[model samples]
Target: MSLPVPPGPQYADKQFYINRGYHQIPKLRLSMDRIVKETVGLRPFRPSGPRIEAEQLGSKTIVHNYGHGGSGWSLSWGTGNMARNLVMATPERKIALLGCGTVGIATARLLQESGCEVTIYTKDVPPNVTSNLATGTWSPASRVCDPAVAKPEFRGVWEDATRYSFRRFQFLLGLNDIACWTDEYSVRNEVPTASEHSAGGEVYEIPGLIPERVRLGKKEHPFAADFVTRRSNLMFNIPSYLHYHLQDFLAFGGKVKIHEIKKLEDIDALPEKVVVNCMGLGAKPIFNDDELIPVSGQLSCLIPQSDIQYKLSTEGANFIARKDGIYLGSNGIVGNWDTTPSKEQTEKVVGILQEVMKNMRG
Candidate 1:
């Protein structure tokens, strides 16, 4: 039998508590390390243009959108929304989506709403593969290139995409079991409250608040900061969430074809002439997009700790509670594409957690 769902008493709580005493997540420690090592920035890449040559594809007929790097999830809804606006001018009644990841899913859904027949051609589907492996945090970490090297117009697109996605997530939160949106506390080290490090601060509040049991103490903080703690709402268990999206797609009459293509021509050959390619890092091989590099992220999971309902990060080490277990990650430091958790890495993560907890007690 499938395991029982974790209790959601605290998650349902509406009034998010901001731990003012000490921070738990290691923002200060991680920032200090990044500044010292000078490796804290995201990969240096940006959209060169609509990943497709308008002249080559016949402008005003086929639309091109993809190459989001890492912000694909955080910014996809907005980008798809913008892409749909462009479709208004296209005489074509249907659109073909190239990838089935979050971007492809959002694009297909949006196209359906526009009264268009959408078909997604992908080798993978929800829960089984692609994107569900993501830690699924809201932070726009990664997917940024050097401003000097990026095109001027692309920055505005990124900005609009991000804002648009934030609102869409808000709307999905109340949609029931379909989308699992919850406020999760992101604990961090206590920096001086007046410092810029406190932008937006921790202990964020989310909508659709469900009353949950409170776990608080006068000095209940993590090991990093002076009484560092937080009450934030972060999405957990992405597979279940993706399942809802897939179901919704089918219910809306959208069709998904499970097929692997060896060349971009295969995609171009589809019955639907208008194609929007959102192949993520896969673009490197499919479209010979060497610009689309995969920056790997590795996370170590401790045996489930229900009471560990908050997240803590310091010096690249991070711990966030999820439906599966407490997700411990060194964030960007654990090496990209080495997605597996090693014994040494696991031990190191435990050490980091000990330090964070110890610091919080002090």
Candidate 2:
């Protein structure tokens, strides 16, 4: 008070850049201990959000909860709740749940909470199905709809889902080994080309969904790129998260059967009066949704680095290090269904990271 305080810009510079002791962020370096493994996953992306509606088929009432695209995990809790409210409208005490992916499991769990006996029918379960391939970021509106085709009325529904899903994710926090944690940094040298089906546009632009992002200056950022920024979001370790949910589902009297359905008639044959279809990508062929497409995605798994706690992405590529290992992801190929992990693509992404380091040193 004796002396006049420094101006705002000078104070910000002093606090953020000049004060090395207080402004301590990590210098980026990725260990080259050859990637332990690599894998690819296909995102069941629907441009018009997930199909959450009820349709009558023969004597059975069918409720749809599929085609969530990249937003499956983020939207699962809300959509499950939405579908369950529909299921509750009926008096059926027993329900048939199709598929065992994230959405399927979430639906079954929600139904269990509603006091319904659940039978999960599927060809595969977690860690083996397509759901395991997701990078598991908390982008709820991702690839959920196409703007041109999206109605003005959809904003209300989309906003509702985002709100509900966020509330559910908070309950999963503080599990062992970063099953749900935050990635705090993302440095971009260039802007990513937005696709028509890109999930980052209007849906996330809603009020009070995501927090504001910060643009980092030279002292605040450690990357080589001319531009740097930081934003925080959730990442669900799909393997562990599913394991936690599936185990509890069984404890709560849920039954799992390994059976594949080839046609709608098979579903009609179920004894349960109500069937909730959370088949995810499998619905593409069975339901013949022409608008749905396979989004080819690949992630390279490097050894876990405790020091690297943030995320990085440029162009169509994404790089992040989680508790398990480093994940290097390529851009989604909208119509591509190939799940083969490309050695060349992984190497290309690695080079991008290396270049970043080199530029930082220079």
Candidate 3:
């Protein structure tokens, strides 16, 4: 099926023909029997954007740094640097960092580098934290904030964090797959309208950081859809990525304690006078942040396929090929706090992929 070409110079520039040397890639195996595990994660989405400023809670200084939504993994390094700056302003060198996810570990390492003694207080560790379940990608603006509610200054913050994080991710490439680039293909019957692209409303965007998407011709790819576009973007193998950072933190003398903060008084009882809060969704309860909404997402992983190296996205579902497994996920359900894996959702997601695989053309 031939899709109607978009009528614009923008789309024209993105069009490209495949090279004669190009070869068809191996097809992904999609079946319910292949499913090995299913997990859910809650993205801490604040309509007003991420809180990065320092607030004094009684005698202790609390550096607020949560509510990144789905961009926590993507914007971690940059936001962590921002939180570290706030901690540096205070005279306290002994610091207590809350949560042990990507944000917490990133900030803890940054603080240690600045000569501050850091200890992580969290209820869970790697592979168990919310960030571990992320569909790891460079999506700094995904459900980040509500433009109507977010302050105008947030645009600058988002850009700075995105640019810095992009540069930092580049340095980790080829390092045992801690971070690497993968081709992402978007397949659909029609080109997405501008409004459809930003269904959650405009947040912030930084173009030219990743390669420009190239529209694929009918004979160029094996996808089932009429309209296909591919672009190279950075992806994190979360398991190894977090393990590497956690080891780095420990090697640098950083400490971690398995403690859950249930209230503000629990934070005040800490020995450290200055604290950095990286509690992604956990902030809703401890900080009483009613503005923080939980955007629940689930990922069903199949056994790892070494040949499937790229990512694919269709209408309602997406797939990410990682060293650990093939991750299958869909759009997050906003205001959903339930973390249990939905059998119905899993079957639907797998069914979509199975159909796509069935329709593949060589």
Instruction: Please report the candidate that would top lDDT against the real structure.
Output: 3
Better of 2 and 3 by lDDT: 3
- In model 2, which residue pairs have backbone atoms overlapping below 3 Å? 45-69, 47-145, 49-144, 143-199
| lDDT for each candidate structure | 0.54, 0.75, 0.85
lDDT for 74 (candidate 2): 86
Cα lDDT of model 3 by residue, 77-179, tens digit: 9999999999999899999999999999989988999999999999999989999998887788888998899888889999998888888898889889999
Error of 3 at 149 (Å): 1.5
Q: By lDDT, highest first, what's the ranking?
A: 3, 2, 1
State the lDDT at 351 in candidate 2. Answer: 77
Local accuracy of candidate 1 as per-residue lDDT tens digits, 1-362: 11222333233333323554432232222211221111121221233522432213533245555665445566568878877776656677677777787777887788888898888888878654546655666644243443545677766666667667777887776555334444344334333331122221212222333233233333343343332224444453665667777788889988899877677667667887677766666555765666655554455555555455455444436665566655565444312554454556656766765665654432
Point out where model 1 deviates above 4 Å.
1-62, 177-233, 333-340, 358-362
Following a full C-alpha superposition, what root-mean-square deviation does model 2 have from the true structure? 4.9
| Candidate 2 residue-wise lDDT, 1-362, digit = tens | 01232222322443344534233444455544557777877778777667898888888888899988778888898899999999999999799999999899989999999999999989898888887877778777777777677677767777788788888888888876434656455556554232321224434555455554555555555566654555666787777888889998999999999989999888888889899999888988778889788877788887776776766665445666666676776566788888788888887777777776666522
List the candidate numbers ranked by TM-score, top first. Answer: 3, 2, 1
